[model samples]
Target: MKSLVALAVGALVAGGIAFAAPASAGCQAGWTPWGGGEICDGPVGSDGNFERCQTTGVLGFGGTQCFIANVGNAQPPRVGP
Candidate 1:
C-alpha cells in the first residue's frame, strides 16, 4: 500500500511538470515583435515554399495565422516598361 501511494505521488509530480511546460511558437528564426503579437518565418512547406506566420493574443490564448506564397508566381518589376 505504501508503494502504491508513492507511485501515485510520483505520477502527479511528473504530470505537473509536463503540464507546466512552456509552449513554443515554432518559428525557425527571425521573431519580430508586433502590435500585441509577433511575426516570424515558419517552416517550409511541402511545395518548397516558405510560410509567413503571425501570432496574436496574450500567451497564445488567441491564435496563429500562417500565409504561404509561391515565389515563382511573382513577376519581376517591368523595368521601366
Candidate 2:
C-alpha cells in the first residue's frame, strides 16, 4: 500500500508540472498597424506599454481524444525598470 501511494504521488507531481507549463497566455492580440497606415504597433510590456495578446496552450480541443496544444503568435512583453 505504501509503495502504491508513493507511485501515485510521483505521477501527480509530473502531471502538475505539465499543466503548469502553460504559463504564457499573455497578450490577446489587439492593436495592429505598424507600417500600414495609422501607425500603432507596440504592445511590448513586462514593465512598459502593453495592449493585448494571448494564446499559448490548450484552447479548443477537437472531437474524441481531441487536442489543441500551444498555437502561437501574440508575444511582445518583457521589460523592466
Candidate 3:
C-alpha cells in the first residue's frame, strides 16, 4: 500500500513537469515578433506545442501574414470520433 501511494505521487509530479510551459526563449529561430505574436518563414517549432492562430490575414500591403502563439495548458483540439 505504501509503495502504491509513492508511485501515484511520482506519476503526478512527472505529469505536471511534462505539461509545464517551456522557458520563453523568445520566438523560435527565424521567427520574428509582430503585433504581440510571431511570424515565421514557415511553421514554428513544436517545442512548446506552439500553434498558429486561425486568423491569417494581410498586414496592409505587406502581403499575407500568420501568427503563432503558445497554447499553455489548454487541451488540444479533439479529432474524429
Instruction: List model 3 lDDT by residue over 9-51, tens digit each.
Output: 4444334334434223322211112211222322335564444
lDDT of 1 by residue, 1-81 (tens): 656544544444334323332234433212123113434544555775656554444322345677764445512101110
Rank the models by lDDT, top first: 1, 3, 2
lDDT of each: 0.40, 0.28, 0.32
Which has the higher lDDT value, candidate number 1 or candidate number 2? 1
Model 3 regions more than 4 Å off: 22-81
Compare candidates 1 and 3 on TM-score and give the better one.
1
Least accurate 10 contiguous residues by lDDT in model 1: 72-81
- Candidate 1 steric clashes: 0
| CA lDDT for candidate 3 | 0.32
lDDT, model 1, position 38? 39
RMSD of 2: 17.0
Stretches off by above 4 angstroms in model 1 are 1-35, 43-49, 58-61, 70-81
Residue pairs clashing, model 3? none
User: Which has the greatest TM-score?
Assistant: 1
